[model samples]
Target: MKSRKTRVLAVLLVLSLLGAACSKSSDTKEKKKTEDTDYEKHSMETKESTEETTTETTEPSQRDTSVRPVSTPTPTPEPIPMLTAADIQSMNNNNALIVYNEVGNVSTIVGRFFHRPVADEDDAINAIKGVQELLGLQTGYFPFAVYGERFQGYTVYTYQQMKEDVTVTNATLKIVLDQEGYPCMLQSSLASNLDYTPSSPTITEKDAEEIVLNNMGSGYRVLSEYTMTTVYTDYAKAQHCYQVYTNSLIDNASFDMPYIVHFISLDGEYINAYPTAFLPTDPFADYGQDSYFKDMVPTDYSFTINVNGNQVDITIPISKNNVDGKYYLCDPDRKIIVADYYSFEFKGQLKFDTQDDPNSFDAAHMVNYYYYTQAYDFYKEFNIESTDGFGMPILILDGYCDESGRAIKNCCNMGIQYGWSVFAATDGYSFGHSLDLVGHEYTHGVTFYSKQGVQYYNEYGAINEAYSDIMGNIMEMYMGETSDTEWAIGERSGDECRSMSYPYKHYQPMYVGDLYYISTSPLSYLSGLDDKGGVHDNSSLLSHMCYYLYMNGMSLEDLTWFFLASIEMQTPNADYDDFYAIFVASARMTGHEEIIPLLSDYWESTGLKGPREQTAENTTLEGYERINIPFYSAKVGAYCVVEVYSVALGGRYLYTTMQWDGIATFLAPADGTWFLIGITEFSDASLSTKVSEKWLNHDLTAWTDDPNDLGYIVFESGKITTFPTYQ
Candidate 1:
């Protein structure tokens, strides 16, 4: 039996070896199949490559068959055509539009253009018809052309139908809207004919001249001559002349008496007239009549007239108002008239000797001359006449004019004593001696007149100063003088004037140091200078704030709004806070509500603390809400240290202690959740209240034992809770 088992085992072992051999043989067959497959694929690739090479070799030109070259042709641009005046005129004529060739006739059209632009062809045609209707011309088939290239281009348009339109006439000017709703004007001659109906009078130019000479006297002489031309259908020209004459009664007269009359004629017809005395009407009426010149007469006089185009310049000489007072030759009557005289070249200067009289020519006179010359030049350019005889006076005084001390002191004294609001240099300061000061003083007068009798102080005072300052700057800008607008009032005063841009630049003891605490005790003591009874001191703040706003790009409108609000809303005794509130309210009123948040943010950023309120509450066991405490505390640390005053609902008053330990944990009570507050240092009872109350000790051992656990502890119904210092 043993031998048979051995034989069986041996056979099994042999069979197992045979199976392993068979498995190995199968694996080898698969590997060989994979290698043969790879070899066959490589062979196929090589055969394809060979075919490609054969093809390339057979036809070398075929190798360039990657892509076909594209041929792009250049594009040609279209040309723009030019237009001519004749073409434009022809187009307008075909359109049946009326044309205005004379430039003067286009005045009405230009006025309409200023008011409104043409909307369409209908508007343009209607404008032409309107002009014809005004001129009482036949409403025939009239086409009007508004040559866009001006009258140089003959553009015409026809009005198919008349449209109802309104007409506005001002004096000799007539404006009409055509069927197309555009305005047009009649040529000057036609307009004159329509304006004035001529009777059966055959008046020749020589006859008209004779009539004018008879009426104006033999002393009159023609000054300037001009030819007025107009083009409607054809050009019409008319001769115009300006005549001047010196009246013997008023001629060669001094300031006290009226000067000679000067008459002007247009085409041998009297048009307008005036006298040399017209310019000094105000000064004559005010001072010349009373103390200065009681009985003044003319000694000797002569006249010289220059004529150019439509302008005429007349120079006349006259005696002084009095040997004592100053001499002036002015034309007051013609001041308001828009005469053709573009300018008056007053070449003569008033001579005064300091040796004869000390107050002969003072600084005030020089200043007056400056202002009068300025005002004269201003109106001359615009052909504006001084209707009110409100020409500024020039008083020449002889002496060394100390603009610094005397003028400034005088202004200040006058302003304070008589409420004059004088604007003069501070000591030797001339930079501030400008038109701005004058305007500022005048504005003060106006304000005083309007407001009755209101004294300025606090907010009102600040506003008053600010108003004057702003207006002063504005007046300077209006007069085209900005060079002297720096904060310095009078650098010429050596050291007398106030600095506008930088008050501290003066090194005034009051303005030195931190601006906010300048008024405080220690700082104030350090700077022992009294700020002009606190006026200058407090006013600096206002000026500084205004400067800040100005630098920040506040517009004139914004400044005006702020000023209005400040003056209207401010009380007599308002402080800085009141000023702030008024400013905020005014900003809101003026549709600048966004400024409120910005202002608040600015205050906070400046480290200024504002008002705040706080409250606390507790819940009852019945789950009802109740107000338990009303206490306030500054936000401190990680938790609030609110003091408990009294309990609202009945509960155990256990004084328990708790702590944050190494990690903070929460403890729940029957009513509310209590947090384990942490402390860094400890303090005794008396010291606790004196220092901070957050250092009190309480139980929190569990949290410290396994702080990483981040676990919480629940206090029983009657257990007390207190906070201890963190270990």
Candidate 2:
């Protein structure tokens, strides 16, 4: 286990890699505007150099050819040419896949590519630069941090993306190097362009701080040190904004008071703010007022205690202070401690602290101790040291209260900076009483430590929540007393708060773009405070995919292992498309390739994947310059784009609005000889136009004089005369 200072420094390093643009202070003192200005101008370098580079290649693994055909690549000699988007697209195989985000960004790329192992940060920079030039990777996206790790005898390097010395949320580039240090795969979600202009802000950092403080109301304040200028995409538009990281000053505030990001524009105008904290269950749900207990793992500190309204016999481990000679709710082996919020103490040799059997509220502490240990033991199976991976003591504060002394009626992981405290209200059926809930909260810590810590907002955040619910339910199935409640979350609390199998029953979307599907529009999300951009509501979509496989024959243990192993394979902003690619990669990497077809088919059914080419009908139309292209956007909620290339002009991009009626109207750029290509947008990533080969890579002269040519569309006499059948 690492020391506290070491752990703090490591997390700070991770946060820096996470592109935390500002420094947050634990101090309560108010910061001046001048200090904030200085803070914003400072830049921290995160690159390191090495001396040796590796250049080698090995045989690729077998893949499931039935689902997607595999194509073996012919080895290339030295001095590989730079990669183009089209070149990358052409490289797709059963083992490799490339996914584009909305607005034409290369959101995800998985599979091996030809390259030598980068010896250091400089080599990595050059490697990225070569690809960036071809991919049209825009300015403002620069590497701020690079980290290397050994996996399966291979070297994997991950680079964090920053813009103008500020962190760009969820943008990253990952490069995988094989045993001999040769490039294996490259994955990225960096921004594609600088559509938004960058200029000097009209307001100071202190003014932005005050705006956020005022928005949070009286009891809240900004973590000045954590505050920083950041680049965030609100819906599809990128904005240079100030991220005012704010949280409650109260010691035991409810989970509802999780850390919030108050986004303010350069002009000092408030754009929006939402909870940035990650938890298991829906923080917005109205928790039921009941609690119960199950069989316990008996220990030396045996006691008969009342849990909610029922009596249960349980035993647990606790520690005794050496000097005071009094027992406290602390365990040394598991490195966990429970604190009583009411007395502002750690059950420390005060009021029944030594009592073998405490009652009423005191019993909640015991319940927490028991279930927390249970949760810890479950994670221990996978060999996780603790939430911090440093054997840091797990701290639990029972009976959290607000400023008015009212029970917060919630639980949350207060983050590693706060000593990894998991606080819950002791009123009614406390959140800590249920093993699943405890596991749910504990998994947040696991995610925090995972290789690509999923952000707690937008698409990735939804996935993060789903991960908790999935593991929480899994823990109940394996550890708790046998029962019929297998796919239900918070079942021990009397109300089946959420149903993973039947998500719609609890008003959550079972599939993307369903009845309860929440929009990611910045206007709607910020004004309505819609669960941090619908993370909770949309989480079920991904969770349902996992549960669907589990119910369709995958063993519970295997499902658990796959999901656990896949976490470290993700990037910060990875969405549904990225998950699909990463999951398939994990299955192949972990010898679970048989499940790929099932997973792929399920994703397609849910609209995450699409057919690459839609059959086209050769038709001749009259007197119209617009084409009514049919697209499958119902499940994805995306818009389509058409790229027309002319010999006289390099290429022209055209846009259109998405219609729910399953048709998109694309207008041609005027009467001319043009070659057509198509693209569409999903919530996170985009898809290329489904078209046959007759329309692509053809000589303009082949169709220039021939009206019957199916390869090109001609607009003569103010009307298109030839049209291809489109899907």
Candidate 3:
């Protein structure tokens, strides 16, 4: 995640309308007008001179006027339009639905496709191809890679998509099957419009590398091993670009962001660059065959550590290499290893040396040992072994630093390079001390290995960040909360970085069009904008949605498993809509369909259905159901204060919220007469007051100091009639 520094955010005051791309050409009529005027002046002068010199006047020409017949031109015939997501949805059975990306490719398809069980890999591929043809997906979607796995009693087949021979970044087609291997649902992020004229790059691979290096400047070196030319879609247009992987030589200096990915067009034009670090931000080390785990002695190390100035004792399971007679900071049973800076640099055995020092690097390792184990145990309950589900060792680099020996304050999952590994650097205090942060980093690995995972940018990156934050908080809760409360991350570090329950407190968006919402509309995957297109900033919308689920009776465990299943159903280029579909599929798959209604309500409330608009409705609402009422104002920054007054409570205001977006959410407190009062800056505009169910029980002091004293006129004569009695 980006550095969680507190600051005020500029509101998205106005909505922008999107139109088709077009070009404008102006006719040069001004020059012609000047020439014509000059000629007219000369002609008039010559006429007068001729009249004075010759004294002869030519007879006025007789005017002739005749109506002419006009011919109509036939209009050109338009090209046959290919099937779109809407068209495909209309043609398919109601049970199966497909969602297309901005580029018109089927990003996700969730539901049963085949009438019967798929036979094998060949059957799955053929079934997908036939579906593509039936849906009129004109692009070529050949399977470049295919694999099968089992989870939650379901057998799943995953196919990576490619165009011609070039790889499509983060594109995949997943075929899920029930226990008997029958096809259940399909998901994809394949490219479309493959008929574009192809041309070879003017710049060679070496030239592309040099261009990227020059653009990246000094103190940065490209990791040539990870560089590859792939097809990336931007603004619905696909182009071949080189994905250059580079990192900063200095860590945490804020000059060159680490794990920077530069997308250079194949023709060598620089497109965009940004850090893919999992905190604000890999293959395999098979140590199982080594003597370390084979001949290791298991032990439990106990230590007293300071957490928010309070001493707490904890125990973590670890192992000692009997062959080397050194204790390693690892739990062999859980397949986790905590490597120190020295061990990572020298590639030596990560030996645990000390246990009593509270401020030493060993203490940091112990902290990671405890939390990583907790996060592992949390996932293990869902039958997931590790990040890869293959018992791969979860490597945690404790006391990690740059080559210059400067301790970085940040901790990022280095899984992009080293599979299933997290490298953290500490300055004054250790990030290992924060459970949510550690779990946040750990979940990054989980997202990396998720079935369709996702690329780390734009809306996809925001979802990635939200997964870590949500699961991190869940993991913190699973391990038993200490200094920090639920739904808030980073409170243990003295600064409440983000609040899942109230995202607005941190200037993060709670809905799609909320204050900090970032637009990925054109679908530029490599946009190097702020916070990676607000990946960390807009992530709260999803996290708060999960929080809403938790508040509306979804158990944490149920939410956890459901989210894990949803991630399995996701695509690499998924946005909010794609996620909504995936989430619905997961709800049914996890046997929690009861939550779908509330989830849908949350979706609409969060603006996933589109921007909030005014609608006609009864003044009164039933029970705890929330309603959005839009109020009109002639100016921006207009205030609409909504209050709930209970006669049972001495006719006093029970709750109030100052809404600026015009939409107000209301909930009835009890059974009796409740007055809904609306105080608005615009008295002429028809408006209604509301106290959103979300803000009903929470403290309203943050919204305003006694909204009744704001001295604003009541909406439509102030007093909305009695609300229907709700149990």
Candidate 4:
């Protein structure tokens, strides 16, 4: 049993050892598994942490999802307030504000208000500011007042304001006052918040008449009564004021029996009224009140009378005065009426009676009389208060009985031969004695003044005649004349005057062909019989040239190019050839390429060439020989030194010598090539046979067209022997 117990104990011990061994092995395995799992978990955690840190550090703040997200913020806007009528009205009434009335009673009222004089700038500014404030302008801006002193009673105020925020931006206000310091009108312009509403002025017909009567106090005579149909507008009223003020007269006799009234407005509309009967004169003794009537008295009748060239015929009738009977004619009874008869031609007989009735004479006669009287009055008024204010001496021979053709021929001959200016009549009896005759003669005077002694022959003459014809046409147009009338002399007289585009229409052999021969001669004599200066034929050429130039879209300025050039450059005795040269050079110089071709064509058409050719080249002067260098070098100290020996014929040599550091430097040999040189003065060669010497020395006869051909020396053996050199 003991042995069995021992064995059991041993077995127990073995069992215990086994149990302990099993426990140790199990714990070790579990610990190892836990450690391995922990290690793996820790490694993963470390890697994740490092990756997160790296991402946080490398990513931009905006892109970082970990940070807070951003969004666009909305901006707050200011509110626009509504403006009330009361507010606007209050603003309009504000003394510090300015208001502008574009239309209606407001304008009239404002005009009347401004008519009164303000004491000072403060008063003016305050008044204008009141208008501005009433106009609803915000603060910080004011209106200024403008007063007219010349009109005696004109005033206006102008102002400006910012539209968006009631800010006063700009303001201008004016007040016009009469000589009596009474307000005539108030004018204002301003920037405002309120839109404008136009209202018509409440002025009745009786009220207007009353105003007129009140303005023309006493002694105001109504020579004639007239009615004007006007649209009821502010502009019309203003114009009416001007008309009434300027036209009213105290007496008709003060205006020479026929009291004429003219109505003109700032807008250029015009009207005239005349009294048909003699005016009543005041018989009261001369008193202090007479000055009032005198102030309102009208001067002589004035009118801008336009004669109809088509319907009117102008005739200067010559009377039988004993003053060189062939040259002058006068009327003692003034029976030879100077009348303007209108129609295509002069069809009425000459009337020797003097009748004021316009219907008794032909339309031409009446129109002519009206124009002459008007022109006379204009001249008189122009010369009223001066010595020789009528611009030189002008003789108006009225009631002269002479043939229109004869008068024209005499005047034209006198003018061309002795510079006499005459206005002749155009009766259909004589050829070439038409409006053109007067126009051409008149143009000579105009040209003399405008151009001041312009060359007369060839192109200039042609242009002159053409311009005269144009002026004639213009004058006809001014006289309300048209080509439809038989008075179109250029079209009627077989083209003697001028055509619209062609001047050759008048180039008849009898009139022009022979005239050219006599005129072109150097010693050409004039016969006082023809209108042209013995060159009647060539005038057509010049006129035609001008016509063509005008037709080619050339402006007056462009046309003046040739005129200016001719006047500036042409010699007194310049002929057609010289004219051609001048034109070519002028056209080129003035940068008028279009004129160049035209000038060329003109020259060619006239059987002439244009300008001469020009050649340009560089020349050099070389030493004659080795020893000749010192001789030339010695000349460097002389007064005249040869610089360049030009090869062209009539070549000019440039000579110059200057001192450098008190040393005389020689520039003759230094040109064209680099060379050593000492300081020396310079002098030009006195040799007249320079070309001959050069030719003999260089043996340049091979290049000569003639033995005397001494083309400019370009270079002398590749060394500058012509021009002086300086170091």
What's the CA error at residue 566 for candidate 2, in Å? 2.2
Model 4 over residues 636-713: C-alpha lDDT tens digits? 332222233433323433322221111111223322432222222211121211222122122422222243544333
- The better candidate by TM-score, 3 or 4, is 3
Candidate 1 local lDDT, 623-691, one digit each (tens): 222211111221221222222211333332322111111112221334554323223221211112233
Cα RMSD for candidates in order: 43.3, 16.7, 24.3, 44.3
lDDT of each: 0.27, 0.53, 0.53, 0.27
Q: Write the per-residue lDDT of candidate 3 for residues 216-317, one digit (tens) a residue.
A: 456666665456566665433466776666764434321113476666786778775556542110132222322335666667868787877778787887
What is the model-wide C-alpha lDDT for candidate 3? 0.53
- Alpha-carbon shift of residue 317 in model 2 (angstroms): 2.1
- Candidate 2 has its poorest 10 consecutive residues by lDDT at 33-42
Query: What does the lDDT read for residue 393 in candidate 1?
Result: 26
